[model samples]
Target: MTTGIGQEREKNMEYDLGAEVAEWMLSQTGAPDGARSTTTLMGLQWDVFPGVWHPNPGTRLFTSWLPIADGCRLLEVGCAAGVTCVVAARGGCTRVVGVDIYPAATDNTRRNAARHGVAGRVEALTSDLFAELDEDDVFDVICSNPPLVKAPESRRIDTATEQMVYDPGYELHRRFFREVGPHLADDGRIYMLTSETLADPAELRKLAAEAGFTGRVHASEAIGIPAPVMGSTPAVVAAADEHGVVRVDFTMLEFQRG
Candidate 1:
């Protein structure tokens, strides 16, 4: 087990500048509760600053491989700081929409869209999963960094960014996979991030089947220590024990309509 104040430092050594600042802000409160996440991501300078959550490694990695196509309709569920939406607009997606449960996220997305001069093509809305989207409206590309990390259930969610990390019963995963297909055009693709070791492959396939879609691991990479979010939950602990170490995989999954 990697247990040491020194080990924590070692883990942080791998994070980029913005992520490091965001992590520090998460660990602080009181006066620092006002700390803001940087707008810069993956070297793409942003016109507006981040309001609440910072972009994670999964979001950064996934944006690098986003398939570019002209006039494609793109949607980002759980858009935190609007990074994916901005990235899509920058990549020339004709219509881009960002939906999040948080008002802060929607505001940030729209503001950033304008800041990027893509306001005409990009829009943001606050929605509970797919509740706010019309059934007739479909997307050619849908992506998200859902709350896939399973931690010991906490009645109180910490920070907005923490919202992306903790999913008690994996409810977000179930709902996203079960309902996402309807809003996805027949030719659309779904991109998302989930824990490599924690996500159940069979269960994911089953969820996709129920939604009339197919899911597969498009890419995955080992990430820094997951100790921060790897609470004392039995299953998580057991997996860590079984591995003889605690390692996290930042995986990108692709889903397609059947």
Candidate 2:
């Protein structure tokens, strides 16, 4: 009888561990704040939280420049949880489609959109960008905050695998530009953001030109970490000296479809 009881306890413990692992995975994707969230951005009340894609600083820059009028169709690629989708909906876009490789992320987006009463205005899908999208499906605006950082060789996955977030290479941005042109309406525009470390402005502009896009620099900013607090390594100090800046610089490139 004691042996049977011990076996039952072990099973219970295993069940608990499995539950914990599931919860942790969910948290890593994004933490939902119940069904809704209230956040303050630039002194304005904004809705955001877990299951919603958190707008990175680059997204914010593009959002600020958006021509928020009725009847605009917006597409956001790599939209994890759809924070930017909600923002676009709130900004008066008639239709917003957010695509990601992860079904859970899209599911989060759907829930968050419903929470904000914008579910009708937003659609989240698991798609490989152009793969699932109809050839003729075009948008007024397209935006993305792609995973631009290259992973170390040891952790690299098969190149042929379709992932929601994976580093293709420095030239992935070039390919994105090439592919986007065909899907953009004549008057359509694209807002893309990536770090200087990942892509240079000149190279991006050239790629856009090849893709039949007229590119312009919309905004640039230096992301800084306090030097004293960031212990000085030789490389860090050298970078600071060269740029006369201790901050990582980022540029927002806007492309207009001609």
Candidate 3:
């Protein structure tokens, strides 16, 4: 039996611990000015900038799994350094558009596309979700590996880099589902990646349903998180086992109009 006062205290402690571990995970990224680094994926050289959402296991996995067909138009939301954008263009996608809220990320995407000689087929734009996209713009395949954390009000996110990690109240995701349909062509599909270690996939599906979209888990694979941060993050604690091994799963969810 717990009193209301005791429950409040426990909640506060959880928030504090989650914040502490979140800061540690972010520090590992060399963020804010993720000074230029390069990595090879999908057989192409891509320059990674830290201020943007640089390629992580989630991004890499999403890129490889996206269904990009020859001559299909593709749009990638939160297209951090354009890993998927470049791959789509080189994979024979007729047009690839990558949008990010950070100008630096969009710039980085442009640079990488040009680096791989796919600039002619790739366009990078600085847009907050679908805000900057033209109403008539439609894509055959729309994909996003969005921020997985449902940031609580206790956490302070002051930079674009922080925005890449925390989606406060899931406002960004709500906006995505509500606005995405118009941008998708007929017979098109949406691909979004979620992680059990970061957020609730069920909640995401609920949001999609509220927006009149049907979603299903298209793929799922277990992945590991750094062991040390497991206990402090309350949101992801249930994802770990008795041995303190984090049993995280990266789930790819597909959506279409109901």
Better of 1 and 2 by lDDT: 1
Best-first order by lDDT: 3, 1, 2
lDDT of 2 by residue, 122-192 (tens): 99988876566878888998888775443333545532221223354545666678777667778888987
> Per the 3 Å backbone cut-off, how many clashing residue pairs does candidate 3 have?
1
Q: Which 10-residue span in candidate 2 carries the lowest summed lDDT?
A: 17-26
Order of the predicted models by TM-score, top scorer first = 3, 1, 2
Clash-forming residue pairs, model 3: 34-50
lDDT score, candidate 2, position 26: 30
Clashes of 1: 0
Instruction: Compute the lDDT for candidate 1.
Output: 0.67
Which of the two, 1 or 3, has more TM-score?
3
Better of 2 and 3 by TM-score: 3
Q: List per-candidate RMSD values in Å.
A: 7.9, 15.1, 4.1
**For residues 207-227, could you state the per-residue lDDT of candidate 1 as single tens digits?**
767877888888887655443
C-alpha lDDT of candidate 2 relative to the true structure: 0.63
Q: Which candidate number has the best lDDT?
A: 3
- Mark the 10 consecutive residues where model 1 has the least summed lDDT: 14-23
Taking all chains together, each candidate's TM-score versus the true structure is 0.73, 0.67, 0.83
Q: How accurate is candidate 3 locally (lDDT)?
A: 0.81
